[model samples]
Target: MMIALTILALCLCTCTLAGELFEPQANAQNTKASGATIKADPFQQRGLCRRWAHQSTVKNGTLYMFGGSMLLKQNNTVQEVPNTEFLQLDLAQSFQLSENTVPWQKPKINGDTIPPAFSAGAMYSGKGDFVFLYEGQTPKNLPEQPSSMWGYSLINRTWQMTDRWNHADENFPNRQSRGASVMTSDGNTGFYIGGLRAYENDTFKGWYYGPEEQFTVIDLAAGKKSKMERLPLGQKRIGPNVVYLPIGKKGSLVLVGGTGEYKVRLSAPVQNATKMDGINPDDVRLNPMSQMDTIWIYDIDAGRWFYQTAVGDKPWERKNFCMVAATSDPDSSGNKTHHIFIYGGGTDYMTPMFGMNDKPFDDMYILSLPAFRYYQVKLGDVKPDARQRMTCHVVNNKQMLVLGGHRVNSSETLKDCRWDELNLFDMNTLKWQTEYNPSDPGDSKFIPNPDVIAALGAKTQEPALGWEDEDVKCLFTGICPGEQGIEAQKKRSNARWRKWYIAVGGAGGALIMALIITMLFLRRRRKENKALRYELEQLQLYFQYQTTGEIYSSTGVNNLISDGDAFVSEKVRPMTFGERVKFVFGKKGSNNQEIPTIFDLPSEKRRETEVEKIP
Candidate 1:
């Protein structure tokens, strides 16, 4: 019984806890009733493969997108064509292009060309109005060195070459694959972080590079030639997502989730390879295979690393996820809180390389710094598929625009899928609204809208709220610590059962005491009756002697007399002790008053009455 009550308490407690965590707000019904409408873009279903690139700069309300690789295939062979031309898209000209009406057309500039095709390392300097393009593979028959860094100025409408950057130094590491390079606000500096580096020889004995020491600060104002910061060699790590966190009156850089380096033994067949043979078989240095969800913060002012708390429930540990930071804020001094949005990355390490046929995630997560609150923004019901290497850009403070990524189908074929549609989520509402081309005949593919691209460069309406000092306490308090509240509620429920048991036990004890007392009283009364009977017998014997005066002394007669006295005592025995004295007094009263029990007294009265009637 006790165990059942405990289980019941636990179940109720769990229900209450769950309700607290995921209960829908009462205002949610009101918001739904209001019914928000989102306009869809006309360019959602176009079968175009556009490489993800940053918005170069906003000039005269026109947003410019530069060089990106486009899919150009022929004869069953697919090749990526790098675009050098600048496409100018007017923000005011945004409208549905119809046959009768002319919409704002994106005009391509012939003279303004960017350095050839690149996939990953592209960043824009908003203040300088220059786009920095660096370190992407050139179309070559064999593996070639990536040696060029190009800059295109939108304001001057010209491309300039830097002599210092052209000169290669021994300290400067080689270009890496899937590496990230971002421009600082000063517009003259670019920070480069981790990716994969080329293996020089077959032996693993060669110096391990491309992981820990792969960070360099490029001074574009100094003609791109900058000295590397010499620091102690840490563990080799890669695939790190880096973002600049704006500190109060200062700035800090934060890096989240990357793989590290470790030693692995190579088989003889693998060891015989050119690059593998260079390394000792016993100590083959390889990129560390650990997936990191850890966030490391680097203070720009202090030149030190400070670790922050991990955000979110165990996130899907993967690489190449899309991340973007807030660029502009119309409210307050600037974007108060440096928010980083992360979405859609691969979970399997071997999957990206070996092509594990699995679906990608569609979940969106936000990391708000200083407060370090990780909010899992509800994206509603979105089916997951492969979306590795997709691009994300912040369109104002509320919405993010996501672009093209690879989708793998059941046949194990990789198809270049463009989410030609833009998904808009209001930060305040946390509800998703999609915009796409409604007129398009093809099925609408989800893509980040280009209008969002325009919005990214626009100033935000308000600066985001940063984490205050009190947020730390608030965060800890909000967390359900070991289900303490649940346990307390369980105890409260159990208290009811405890009260019931005490009541029942008290009633049962009273009843048992009453029954025992009644039985004892009845037993004592029976003993008293027996004692009164003995006293009555003795009185009867005394009465017989007084009534007779002289007695015949014969054996038979004495026996008879004794028996008769015993019978009279038994018959006339008092019902209670008090009754014995009353019986004795009543017999004496009848004798004194000459009671009518005597037959001679009645006959004498009858004879006297008859003589009086005859006269």
Candidate 2:
């Protein structure tokens, strides 16, 4: 019997699991059969093939993305070759253009005179429309830093050389694939943070150790360089990723997660130096590898560092995630709140086996401040399989467009190959929508390089052409060329008023409810006090009559005509009709024991009393 019961239970469990698996599909089919198709976004398109080292920058109504390496076949060898040219997309026109009808036309800038192929050491000066090109790896075996600093100007449509052009100085070290630069809008200032430099000793040939000596702040306007600060060093140190936050007028720069040294080194000293008090050179040791989860904020005006505390339900400890500043305000404040959106990168595991299973991250997160909260966005109800090194860009206030990255799933043939799926996340709704790029069918196919997917939108419809007055105004207004244009001031004002209304209404409602409750309690207490006083007064009168054996009436009448006894004298008489009634009710009846009546009470003559004389 027990065996039969167990079999029945197993069957029931299997049926339940099967029901759950097919329930969603059944519902979806029913909805589809009713001719209700899910809403599809019109602007979705397949991205172009590109490399990780490409440079992307936004300018007047256009997003200009330039050269990076792409895999090309030469003879029988497949190798990464640098892209010579750049592409420009008119964002204003793109936003208004229908995805089905209009295809992205890549316009060549400076056709044959394009700069040589490079990667990593490129910086952008947002205000002047110039990109500062410096050190990067070449197709040749040599890791090279450009002999001269090249400045490409967007306004003049030309490259210019300044007196400030020079290679990395002794204190300012440079090497390819080590650091990145971020430019502020104030024109003259920018920061060059964390890169590698070559170091050599007599015993060993020179080798490149990354996350080198110190970060440098380059004053392009002044043509001077200074060390920003040195990160704490121990063991397993890596370069830092720096980005600018331009929401406020006096904007600040943010440094996200990076690798740091933790190990103590042990070595014998060759010469006698001032012995450090806590640190012993002879007993040197290197600590374990640790990834830094700390975020450092640099104030441009104050020139100081302030730390923000870590937040989120499950905070991520990661480095090299893509960080982008969200320029549009969801709160409708013309003063756009700075939002830093971070996605996948490599992680340090602090173990002897490094890179054994180190894959890129697919998780997406956003950091919003003044509130200082990190929300792990749910892309779908179910978590996606792990992905790493993905590229992401904010398309607008509503959506963040994400492109290819390396996946961790080992069963697939393209184990370390790039992903081809185009995923779109609606920031407002936190929903993930995916579309397979028809141009690039699968991971194995030659897909667009991850770096080429720059943030571009539709162009304005009214102007009809790229070179028009309305077109210029639309771009300068901070609206992407296509989709619904942003009305900056009006939207911000409405958001501010809405927040104010919620706060004020909440406070007023609470106070009004408290006042009403207090009034009701006081009114009920007053009624209870009146009823209690009436009962107490009656008790008091009854007690007085019982103790004194006298009644004093308000009409100057005494109800108890007492005999001359000590306890029952005329002086101790009931004073009022009310008091007399109390005295009569207080006495026991002579007839039946169950009933006590005033008429059955003992008469004054039959009552025994004793009188006490007082001086």
The candidate maximizing TM-score is 1
Give a tens-digit lDDT track for model 1, residues 476-498: 22222332332343464467446
RMSD of 1: 41.5
Q: Which stretches of candidate 2 lie over 4 Å from their true place?
A: 1-50, 72-77, 93-114, 138-140, 146-148, 160-173, 185-188, 198-213, 219-239, 246-249, 264-292, 327-338, 349-357, 381-392, 401-424, 433-615
Specify the poorest-scoring 10-residue window by lDDT in model 2.
Answer: 448-457
Specify the highest-lDDT model's number: 2
Q: Candidate 1 regions off by >4 Å?
A: 1-64, 72-88, 91-114, 140-146, 163-173, 186-188, 198-208, 211-213, 220-225, 230-235, 262-292, 326-338, 351-359, 382-386, 409-425, 436-615
lDDT score at residue 237, model 2, on the 0-100 scale: 35
TM-score of every model? 0.50, 0.48
What TM-score does prediction 1 earn? 0.50
